[model samples]
Target: MVVIGAGAGIGLETARQVRAGGGQVILVGRNPERLEQAARDLEPIGTATFDATDTDRLQRFFQDLSAPVDHVMVTAGGPFYMPLANMDLAAARRAFDERLALTLGTALYSRDKVRAGGTLLFVGGTGGRRPGVGMAVMSAATAALPALVANLALEMAPVRVNLIAAGFVDTPLSASLLGDQLEARRAELRARLPIRRVVGPADVAALAVHIMCNDALTGATYDIDGGQQLLPH
Candidate 1:
């Protein structure tokens, strides 16, 4: 299994779940220290250091693969929260790299690495399925990934490709974005969810592991969002 953007939250939890299920995990990320630390935490698993946005490095990383991998879990993207009017060019580039370009690059690279009957799971956003302001580029790019994943599912044939559209996940990534108001934001967001609770990384991880190991599920987008996407604003 190959986990892209493996860092401190969903990716790490997913790696644990996959390992528990007896899969040989390979973690990928741009941060050498963080990647190495995550690999150490995941222990005995493989690790690759490469920026998803760097096409050359991504290509080389894939080329260096010794054998075909079974599962490709792409948690490569992160949200870029900014009002369109206030957003700068650099911010826009970050959004593109994190969401759109990253997915395309990872998929293109994983095109060969994924084995027959294998699975490619992309983590998309709930905001994307149901759009909102202040999250413009993140939503758009995430929404686009599922369509691409579906097409890839067809083209890749027996290799399944799906997405886990998560919502309001309380993770390090979100904490960094939310800053001091993280808890407050989580409380407010949880109130709107049908489950009336903010989901943790483990919740999303469980669903991801299930989807990756399941054979019959392909081109499916699991709304693992505590049913918040179903509610109206």
Candidate 2:
């Protein structure tokens, strides 16, 4: 299994679960230091350093995989928390590269190597489904992710393609976005969710693993948000 964007967020947690399930995981990240630390935490697995937005480098990295990989999970995207008016065009472009372009590149470079019946899971967010003021670009890219998965699933018959539309979870990525208001935001989000609690990384990881292993599932978008997306604005 190959996990792109395997930093300390959903990607890291997914690595942990895949390892726990006896699956060999290769983590790819942009920072060598963070990648090394994550690899240590997820010992017995492999790690590689590469910028998720670097298309050429990403293609090279995927091509160098030991052999045909059974599963490829693209969890490379991060939050670009800025109001529309304040959003930086460059930063938004970078975000799209990691979120959407990376998926495109991965499919182009590694699609042939994905064994028949193998799975490709894209990790996007609920903001894509229900756009919020500060999540414009990410929301747009993620909302299109499932559609891409659906299209890929059809074109890559026998090779399943699906998406995990995750919501606000307690992770480093969320921490960075929420900042000083982390706890306060969590509380606010919890009140909105039918479950009445913050979602955990483990909560998302479990569903991701299920999608990877379930042969019957294809082009499915599993909402692992604890009913947060169902809440009224």
Candidate 3:
């Protein structure tokens, strides 16, 4: 299995779960330091460092693989946070391009490289499903992700494709994005969500591994968001 965006979040946890399931894992990310740390902790078969937006490098990386991997999960995306009133058009375009390229490029390049019965999984956001204030561009991109994966599932039959649409996962990335408001947001969700807690990386990773192992699951967008969708907006 190859886990793109294997940093200190859902990506790393997914890699850990796959490894725990006795599968060899290859961790991919743009940050060499984080990759090194993850490699040390997870002891994956290897690690690859490349900007996921670099189409050429991404394609070549898969092509050079010694054998077709059984699973590939992409949890890579950049931070795009701001209300429409203060939105930066240029930044939104860049965010959209990077998000689409990473998801689509991986599917396009790895479609043939993934063995039959293998899985291609993507991580999206619940904000797309229930778009709220301060997440206009991100919500749009997130909404587009599952649609892209659904098409890939049809086009790449026998090679299952699915997406995990998560919400407010408690990761370093989320903390970074939320800054001082992280705990406040967690409190809000705990008070209001059906699950009564913030969704964590382990929660999302477990679902991801399930999707990878379940052959019958494809072209689906599974929400692992602590029932955030059930709450009133």
Q: Pick the candidate with the highest lDDT.
A: 3
Q: What is the lDDT of residue 167 in candidate 1?
A: 80
Q: Positional deviation of 137 in candidate 3, in angstroms?
A: 1.7
TM-score for each candidate, following the candidate numbering: 0.90, 0.91, 0.95
Using TM-score as the measure, the top candidate is 3
Residue 79's lDDT within candidate 3 is 56
Candidate 1 residue spans exceeding 4 A from truth? 89-94, 189-192
Q: Indicate the worst ten consecutive residues by lDDT in candidate 2.
A: 123-132
Ranking by TM-score: 3, 2, 1
Better of 1 and 3 by lDDT: 3
lDDT of predicted model 3:
0.88
User: Across residues 1-233, which tens digit of lDDT does each residue of candidate 1 receive?
Assistant: 88887876888889988878777888888789888888777783578877777777887888888999888888876767678778897978776765666667767787888899998888887776555677777777777777887887898778888988888889988898879999798887677777888899899999998887789999878888788767767
Comparison by lDDT, 2 against 3, better one: 3
